[model samples]
Target: MTRALLLVDIQLDYFPGGAFPLAEPEAAAVAARTVLDSFRESGELVVHIFHVATAPDATFFVPETPGIGFHPAVAPLDGETTLEKHQPNSFIDTGLETVLREAGVTELVIVGMMSSMCIDSTTRAAHELGFVCTVVSDACAAPDLTLGETTVPGASVHAAFMAALDGSFATVTPSASLV
Candidate 1:
C-alpha cells in the first residue's frame, strides 16, 4: 500500500520559547526528524501541515508570525508539499484529502506537536475518511492542561490521548520502530 508521512503542526509555536510551547518539544522534533529521514530515503510521500490561527483573540500562530513557520529540524524540503490549516483537523478546507488521494496514499504515518489537539483531530478525521493511520507516540508532545480544578500533566495527557487513538483511529507506535 502507498503510504505518506503526515507531519502535522511541527511548527515554531509549539516548540520552546515560541508562543505556545509543548512539553519535550525538542525531543519530539528530533524523533520526527528521524522518521522524516526514513520516509525520504524510502521515497514515500511527505506532507507538512502548519496551523495558522485566524481568530482575532488567538495568542499564537497568527498569520505572518514566526511561530507559524515550521521548526528548523523538521522543515519541509523543496519537493515536499506544505499545507496551511486554520483548524485542528488538517483536512478541513486544506485539500489534504485530494493531495493524498492523488498521490495514491492509502496509509498515513502521522507525527507532530500538540498530541491532545491536532494529532488527535487529524487522526480521527483520517480514520473516518477511510485512510489507515499509524501515529508515532514518542514523536508527538502536548502541554499540560487545566480542566476545572484538576491540572493534568503533559505526559499524562499525551499518553491518554495516544491510548485513546490507538485501537480505533490509528495504530500508535514509536519513531524507532518505524525507522
Candidate 2:
C-alpha cells in the first residue's frame, strides 16, 4: 500500500516569535524536516497541510500576512502537494482526501504542530476514512490552554494526546525510526 506524510500547520504563526508559538517549536520543525527529507528520498508522497485563517484582518495566519506561510525549516519542495484548510482537521472543507486518493495513498504518516488539536483531529479522521495512520511523536507539539487559570503543562498535554492516539486512531512513533 502506498503511504504519504501529512504534515499539518507547520506555519510561521506557530513558531517562535510568532502569534501562537508553541513550546519547542524549533525542535519539532527540525524533527519534521528530517523525517520529510528521508521520506522524499524514498519517493513517498509528501503533502504539506497548512491552515489559512479565514479572518479579515488577523495578522496571525491571515492570507495576507506572512505568518500564514509555511515555516522556513519545513518548507515543501516544488513537487510536493500543498493543501490549505481553514479548519483544524485538514480533511475538513479541504481537498486533502481527494489528493491522497489521487496519489494512491492507503496509509498516512502524520507529523506537525499542535499535537492536541490539528494533529489529533486529522489522525482520527484519516483512520476513520480507512487509512492506516502513524503519528510522529517528536515531530509534533502542543500547548495546554484548555483549562483557564489552572493550565496544564504542554509536555504533559502532548504525552496524554499521544497516549490516547497510540493504539486506537493511529500508531504513535518517533520520526527517526519511521524513516
Candidate 3:
C-alpha cells in the first residue's frame, strides 16, 4: 500500500518562546525531523498541515502572525503539499482526504503538536475514512490542560491520548520504530 507522512501543526506556536508552548517541544520537533528526513530521503509523500486560527479571540496561530508559520525542523519542502486548517481534524473542510486519495495514499504516518487535540481528531477521522494510520508518539507533544479545578500534566495528557488512539484509531509508535 502507498504511504504518506502527515505532519500536523508543527508550527512555531508550539515551540518555546511562541504563543502556546508545549511540553518537550524541542524533543518532539527533533523526533519529527528524523522521520521527515527519512521520508524525504526515501522519496515518500509528505504533507504538512498547519492550523490557522480564525477565531478572533484565539491566542495563537492567528492569521498573519509569525507563530502560524511552520517550525524549521519540520517545514515542508517547496513541492510538498501543505494544507491550512482551522479545525482540530485536518481533513475537515481541508480537502485532505481528496489529496490523499489522489496521491494513492492508503497508509499515513502522523506526527505533530497538541497530541490530545489535533492528533486525536485527525487519527480518528483518518480511520473512519479508511486510511490506516500510525501515530508517532515521540514526535508529538501536548500542553498541560485545565479541567475545572484540576490541572493535568502535559506528559500525562499526551500519554493518555496516545493510549486512547493505540489499537483503535491508530497504531501509536515511536519515531525510532518508523525511522
Candidate 4:
C-alpha cells in the first residue's frame, strides 16, 4: 500500500516557551523527526498539519504569531505538503483526504503533538474514512488533563489515548520500529 507521513500540529505553541507547552515535547519532536527523515529518504508523501485558531481571544496557535509556526525539528521542506487546520481533526475542512486520495495514498504514518486531541481525532477520522493508519506512540505528546477534583498526568493521558486508539482505530507503535 502507498503510505504518507502525517504530522499533526508539530508547532512551537506546544513546545517550551510557547503557549500550552506539553510534557516531553522535545522528545516527541525528535522521534517524529526520525520518522520524517525516513519518509524523506524513501521519497514518500509527507503532510504537515498546522493549527491556526480563528476565534477571538484564542490562547494558542493564533494567526500571525510565531507560536503558530512549525517547530524546527519537523518543519516542512519546499516540496512537502503543508495544511492549516482549525479543528483537531486534520481532515475536517482541511482537504487532507482529497490530497491523499489524489496522491494515491492508502496508508498513513501518523505523528505529532497532543496525543489526546489531534492525534486521536485525526487517527479515528482517517480509519473511518477508509485509510489504513499507524500511529507512532513515542512521537506524540499530551497535556495534563483534569476532571473536576481529579487530575491526570500528561504521560497517563497519552498512554490512555494510545491504548484507546490501538488495534481498532490504528496500530499504535513507537517511532524506533517505524524508522
Clashes of each: 0, 0, 0, 0
lDDT of 4 at 168: 96
C-alpha lDDT of residue 112 in model 4: 94
lDDT tens string, model 1, 17-59? 8999989999999999999999999999999999999999999
Q: Name model 2 segments beyond 4 Å from true.
A: 56-59
lDDT, model 1? 0.95
Alpha-carbon shift of residue 170 in model 2 (angstroms): 0.4
Roughly what TM-score does model 2 have, to 2 decimal places? 0.95
| TM-score for all models, in order of appearance | 0.98, 0.95, 0.98, 0.99
Off by over 4 Å in 3: none
lDDT minimum window of 10 residues, candidate 2? 55-64
Candidate 3 lDDT score relative to the true structure? 0.95
lDDT of 2: 0.90
User: Can you write out model 4's per-residue Cα lDDT over 1-179, one digit (the tens) per residue?
Assistant: 99999999999999989988998999999999999999999999999999999899999998999999999999999989999999999999999999999999999999998899999999999999999999999999999999999999999999999999999999999998878
Clashing pairs in 4: none
